[model samples]
Target: MRTPLFLLLAASAALAQTPRPGVNYDEAKVGSDPLPDLKLTTAEEWTQKRRPEILKLFEDNVYGKTPAGIGAPKFEVTATKTDALGGLATRKFIHISLPDRPAWPGMDVMLYTPNNVKAAPCFVGLSFGGNHAVSTEPDVPLSTRWMRESKEKNIVEHHATEATRGTESSRWPLEMILKRGFAVATAYYGDIEPDHADGWKEGLRAAVSKEGANTVWKDGEWGAIGAWAWGLSRIADYLQTDPQVDGRHLAVIGHSRLGKTSLWAGAQDERFGIVISNDSGEGGAALMRRDFGETTAIITKAFPHWFTPTYKSFAGNAAACPVDAHMLIALAAPRPIYIASAGEDHWADQKGEFLSGKFASPVYALFGKKGVGVEEQPAIDTPVGDFVGYHNRTGKHDVTDYDWTQYLNFAARHWAK
Candidate 1:
């Protein structure tokens, strides 16, 4: 498609227009909203009708059930070298290997929990770098995995440095998780897939492409977000078998690119009991039809590898697409889904994201839950309701302790059962 055509279909999403333009975040109308009859009269309906349909919606639109990254990844325990911030005892480290191939080999992961505790609920997140980058808690294991875009060569070769790790700690708030009795599980997203034009040249897509033709990744099989979500399922796979994990309360979480992945993971795999999205913007939580800032065109061009080639066509012509963000949010129906946005981050479309939660509410109501507690967007700090919830933090396009506290509270209200 030509560049102008790309803008014609999706440029409205990434603009910096004042007071927001092109689309209305409130009661915004789009192509069409299928699955509108969501009023659950009985509990049985929630389990059989509402919940399953939501999952199907997510599969068809976003993740499409990407299989977990394959092969026995080279696993290691590196948590012994440090202290868990907030006085919590924990183990942290890196898991290295080109599980499929070494093009984008090496993964650094950090795990925090009460030492040796069994059946603990865990929160999983995707980070930007090697394990050592996540925290200075001497408890945070130094990473050994090969990271591309690095200056030094290691056993894995050309990997990112410990300095590059945990650079986005503002989004993680591990100390908050440690104090809450919840385990924080994280891995560098690049280990699963790189964020570049030809990233598929490395990671699981290349690995899975060799043997599993039936997996269907070609059209839009596994973008960086898809790969990260797939990793969440693998984490779930590992958690299910681990003694310390509760398995029932696994919360797949992410911010920005990772935020988009979190929604896809929670929707595709029921294994993730809760999903939290922070400034997921275009593909994360905002209503695609709203055509707000960071439209389909902007994301596709800026990060071509983020989705499938088929995705680029919808750039400006988003109305032609079968689904919108509401449908994506709906896919996680009945499962507690929390979306956070920053008031100043218009690029992320806080209003649009809130409306998506509002639009998807009817589907949730069908399952006997209030999807969005209110119709009109409320003040930034006012936390409200159950089921689908959204709140604008007093900040920018990042995650903070305030966001974590709300998420933990939301999870506590829903997942604590």
Candidate 2:
């Protein structure tokens, strides 16, 4: 006898809520070994003594080791317009070329800096769509790179067209950011590595392989996330060279997968003074051990190229992983980092993300800085923290005006001196 349709639906909903052992949810159990002692007298001592071990653990088990010299990319300015955004902003397009791979299409960077500010504190991030999608400005060049097409978004034949322009504008409020005296820099993530499993064949990984046989990453080496994070650092390298940008005040920000890239970039590169992750759940700001939503197994299976093969070892056994998201956040010691979530985005595990920030507080204390001040997750839209900040806004898993407001406020507190 088959079950009734209504009964099947009801059972599915019930199962979703029920926390299955070692699956959707895990017992909140911390390891017996304590976190690297944040009680050390000086932040310098803590950095010198404990930071390396934590960094190594994450590289070994999660994000994988980023090869050195990934930063040394040549930059070329392709175009510039002083009268963009109705004369309120200056738009510049840059081309980033990797060594020994001049034939590769390379990455394109779009920068919008307010004309009023001589040296603006900029927000640098990787975008899911092409740079053209960030704004409606006619000057922003269209990306010719391979894109994950969406007919609804007007991206036809795996290529970006004019109709896709400004589609992602909600995620990147350029005019608002410019009016607030901040600059925004963005690059298409696919230019670094396409999102598909075989994307490595056309990206930096392939470029590295062409340099020498030994440079090629073995299986389980750095994956798409690492390449995207490395791409952000290359953007940072260009930002440091520009006179319009205050390199010391650079902040790296991202949403969803790019948010994961932002955290990893901030952790590896100290040049980013402020790091912000919006709905960067699961492999991002959320603790892996929580298993509340978007479990390790789920992510690995969905995107096999996002992490190393070593990460598979702990897919169903997150408790055995030597490092957790909290440790990844802690790696940004003393830097002002903000982790935002959405009340409706349980798949990103809002609660798990908040707890990671809370657990990372002790490391901030070592630098005489504060962390998320509250013990419990605050009410929706209530932003909290000192050096480490978080807010689960009343929305879904997308960046919005409210999220940007909190980030601007947080940046003002730290960057506005």
Candidate 3:
């Protein structure tokens, strides 16, 4: 039977009005409440009082509070190669472990510093692939840890293989970074913990828990993201001791989930002079209040292990959540941060990421710093802002050389000045 034209049109309208999973794109539906004001007048007030309060809100409700008394990480320089990368850079491998918590499998960090520069500024980040995947060098050990299975990424049977080597080299760009006089320090995310629901059982979280593998996570306990961030700080700890690297000028950077990790790490550790987020939509740079692509509900359900159980409560009711991504950006304050989004990556909500920086501008103003200066989101490919940098790159979800160019320029501006 043929349907009438008007009835068909009416049905189409009804279907359009219905919301689908991961398709929350309406701007009108975004949460309208004003972001929690940085009500204090002085920088001291913001720093001494409100900053800590906001930090705790994220820790307690979102990422979970990092348990204290884990004690200092013990660092061992496993390898040093001054003639690495054909003598263009010096490479060192540092194995970091907790003395008291020997059950926890610690991470191995890879460092590359430009041989031409002494105490070169460094970029510290976590990689989805192991260090062997970042460089083509055969000597870089293949990570034997549990990895998520992906045939395309060459991670087979939850393990990294020969095919995985240099799979992610395009993202690292160690030569380009070294030529620009910046050091790169990175570790595999799985080294700290495998990225899965039961990752905690074999990760640092379990090692610290009194019950070991039998530990049941509490509502506000730290999750995978917290553990990864803690690992970044440990890299910072080792970088500070390396004469070839400028630890004081370190930048903590990550992409996707790791981008969220970098933001949380930068917020807690003031040593990261710059924080960069690439396509870290939703729980990373995007404001949760905006029911855009990837909502709190979507992320929480898909990867509940990434955040505190408390965060799951605000799944559909994001406005009720005590903190927003703007507050997370605000925590960076006077320090320079670069938030990047991809043009085709709607799943991460490009506009929501831009608005995060815009809303965070007032907090930056408190410290006499500027943020994304425009009133509206800039056109695609147009980068904006000062102390708080942002750009919607002309690509898909992954990071690329275009993104690296902006980062190198942004870091040079602040680091050189």
Candidate 4:
């Protein structure tokens, strides 16, 4: 049923692109031929090669023309608490209050750390459910936010809400993170006004009267992804002041659409030490050129608010867009960027994600860092790259322990302290 419509749209899209040839990346543009050697005889050349390339990549791909120039956020810790996880029963919850006023119902960050704190590198993420659902820990703060698809029918009465919390516990293993000396900090993605086009007028942008202020994203403007990514950046700003967190070694991670947010946040904010994109197919780590799974037309038609008004027109005309996933990835050059996918996740384009990583290599090579796994895509379970990483794990779209293992390994290599 839907397949024929997709074919017709794809056919027309291919026809439209036939008239004007786009960026000439057809030839294999690898190695030093296109990128002449910099004067790397001194330390200055190394910094120049590394930092500017990373910055430029962000400029072109991620938050096009946004301020990567803003100063780090000042975190004002308003509260703290602890709880124990299931195994060996050692985990805790620390609630942080962000420093932005009239409060605007500030984000709730629950930090899961090892019982013994020498401070470990954390794999932080934003989840659909609240922190309480991340683990079975009895003490983790019960979420106060409204969950959309919960059995809890009434939020105003608050009687039926007790059972509603901690229902999605299996997906988030906060206890597993703590036992391994890693801290997991998470916030409900919907705390910023349940991710829709219209509801955004009620969140941070409007609630605080911050509408139409001096910023890259304006009032009633930035979509759910941007708002979520912006929230993640604010979380990054909070992490810098924590003694329990090694902020210099933090890894920003997310799954599916949130995976897209992770990549965008990593690209926009340099404070994030590394990035992990799990099944972030289109508008993320997968190349638009491949058009394997999710297409620009589908994303635009369904989720109109996901991108700017300018982005919707490129639905069938994606080839006309100035950027591709590889270019989006180039935005994280020199920094350790990991693009992960599942073998069965056709909606996210497994092979196309691999291609995007491979395509971003020239930019990484500009700084002598390996970008993809190898010349060809490796079999599932094999991880690759010290700088830019890629792996196709066995299973479906959602993230797993296997995916987490690769990200930790990548983090260990980059943040070797």
Candidate 5:
């Protein structure tokens, strides 16, 4: 028996309008019990006492535990061009190799420092494609790593080709970054671990695990996001050694999944003085308990390798999770952090991101720093905050010139002092 077309259409419409339980869109619906009180009077006391507990909760349930004391890698400068980016910048391509692991693959680091500064504060993040894809510089090396092919982007056969160069130039804005008197450093995320579930076999995850050990990650064990965050820390290790880099002022920034990585990296590694998240959404800056767009069920099912096994248990039960996104933000207390959102990127939950910043304000206050100043979400493109910053720009899910403008301004305001 076929249902009437009118009835079916009406049913579809109703279904679309109906909101799912635990998945809230209305700001009024957002309510959670107060975060655990550490009972510390000073911010320094909170950092000494509560911070470790919060970090442990995230590691035990969310991004999983990364091993401590991962030794430094050997850095080799493969190519250096003093006259690059039309002589306004100097480009350096470096090879990073783990000790006694020749068979394990090494990663490449690309840097662009402004010629005018002896030591410049820099923005460091992982890039999606090869280094050559970030800029059109002829000297930048093409990546031989396993790449996801996109016919639209001109990548062919799961490999990067000449056509793939500078395909992601808009996201990078290298010349603009250099002109702002800040150096830029990036490495391919795949160099540390590929995005797929099986990619652990080919990357550092497997190499670092004990020989003959089960490579399969257990509950609370490190996942791909953990591995990528670990990789960024390694880059920081290298930057500290470079005379041309103002290591103390480095900002780690990323978009989408990499944005999540940036937050996690900033939380675990205090070497990053500033952290920025561009539409990081649920696992990045959005409050998970809001049960807003891009619910835990959707994320974990799509990217099983991104978080720990324990994380999956809280899929439909967000309240059951011990730590929410606000706690993650609090982990970076007292440090300058920025969270940006796109008006059209609902899957990333713009309002939820703002609320996370708001909830995190108390932790910042404990440290004698202000978080995002406004109680409500600010107007589009109107960035707000003191030590913590946030803005929801009018756009879809991607980085833009407007975003960079705000970032540069934020960095100058906080780090210039």
Candidate 6:
């Protein structure tokens, strides 16, 4: 039977009217290009041939290639407290800078190691708030850099105040983590560059660019996410030199946007044995093709500075994108990776995050490692999977004790041996 021309036109109009700004909950309405295959049979083939190709696709199409000419970071230990955090741990503040780039404002790194441990496994992450915001201690110096304005978070006039200290302490359970025999190293993400569009002018990106502040970013040039990932790597370099840290067991973790940063950092640098993402949507663990809560069109428009300018092309036409979130997860193959979501974080596409890990399972199998084994998404608060652990916790988008508990357990399962 042939369909009438008018009826066909009506159907096309309805399709065009599908809300681009609205959330999509129906599976039938979702569309995705088939994931790029993990076709190689042996680890050697994957490492030598296929792996590099996938990596290049991401470098060129998504996060952009990390620039190579930046000078090595110089570290200065400005303060050391042997009896910090109520004598539960030793804390140190290290000022990191590039000697060649005097114009750039470098970062301050805060590290805490357990009191009795000879060598403790470390967690490396970037905080949206500064080091002072992460700890309740009064001695921790307040960050003087520009911060995203948030009256509730206690930032006034683009600067963090005394009231901002320990505001994000709940997100970072330092006392619990230290008692569990782990060290923590963190730096403020803004220290690399502020989150706004024009932030690059004052950051390392401009300092290293040949054209300086006036330089226009090319399509595949590194973006804010890449710059932040580079900062994380520099912190890792310093950890390797610390005798109190178990450098071999270092884990990279982040929540929300920083979660996206950690994934990119872990993919590029293999020094992190465990990788964790919490509520990282859109450009993070959620599949970009899924027309779910947050879409490619939305993220690219709102946070264009976070990715390669070429990424903007995939908005509303995600099927044409060469890579998907699953490929990003695959890049961390054989390593213990954990993707976490919250019950109320629909904007992050919780199910989509789980599916990325599921799709990446084949790569893990190639290395004789397990992945998210369940065929379907588990109920909220019920943790699942093996090497690729996942848990849709029972709350909103923020990180909680439940999420941290899973990460600690997952890290122990893989690293405690």
**TM-scores vs. true structure, each candidate:** 0.80, 0.90, 0.94, 0.77, 0.91, 0.94
Summarize candidate 2's per-residue lDDT along 316-349 as a digit string, tens digits.
7876777888888888888999999988776788
* Candidate 6 TM-score, C-alpha based: 0.94
For lDDT, candidate 2 versus 3, the one ahead is: 3
lDDT (Cα, tens digit) per residue for candidate 5, span 66-99: 9765556899989899989889988998888888
| Model 2 alpha-carbon drift over 4 Å, by segment | 1-42, 210-220
- Which 10-residue span in candidate 6 carries the lowest summed lDDT? 9-18
In the range 225-328, model 6's lDDT, one tens digit per residue, is 99999999999999999999999999999998899999999998999999999989889999988878778887787678889999999998988889999989
Instruction: Tell me, by lDDT, which candidate is best.
Output: 3
Backbone-clash count (model 1):
22
lDDT of 5 at 254: 92
What does each candidate score in C-alpha RMSD?
Answer: 5.6, 5.5, 6.9, 7.6, 5.9, 7.8
1-417: candidate 3 lDDT, tens digit per residue: 854333432332233334455476777776676566656578889999999999999998999999999988999999999999999999999999999999898999999999999899999999988999999888898999988776677877789999999999999999999999999999999889888788888989898888988977788899999999999999999999999998789999999889999999999999999999998988899988877877898779767889999999998887788888999998998899999998877778889899999998988888888899899999999999999999998877888999999999999999888
lDDT for predicted candidate 3 compared with the true structure:
0.89
lDDT of each model, Cα atoms only? Answer: 0.68, 0.82, 0.89, 0.64, 0.84, 0.88
**Cand. 4 TM to true fold:** 0.77
Q: Per-prediction count of colliding residue pairs? A: 22, 1, 0, 2, 0, 0
Please list the residue runs of candidate 5 whose C-alpha ends up more than 4 Å from where it truly belongs after superposition: 1-40, 211-214
Cα misplacement distance, residue 234 of candidate 2 (Å)? 0.8
**Number of the candidate with higher lDDT, 1 or 3:** 3
Worst 10 residues of 1 by lDDT: 5-14
lDDT of 4 by residue, 1-417 (tens): 343332443343343223223322222421121221222333345445644654453344333333332333445454454435433333434344334444446677776666576666777789866766665556556677655442332323322155546665555655555666677777877666555445455455444444423334422244557667888877877676777777877888988778888987887777777888988887778776555566677676655555555566566665565566776676676688999988767667777788778877766777667778488887988887767898998987666878777776677677774
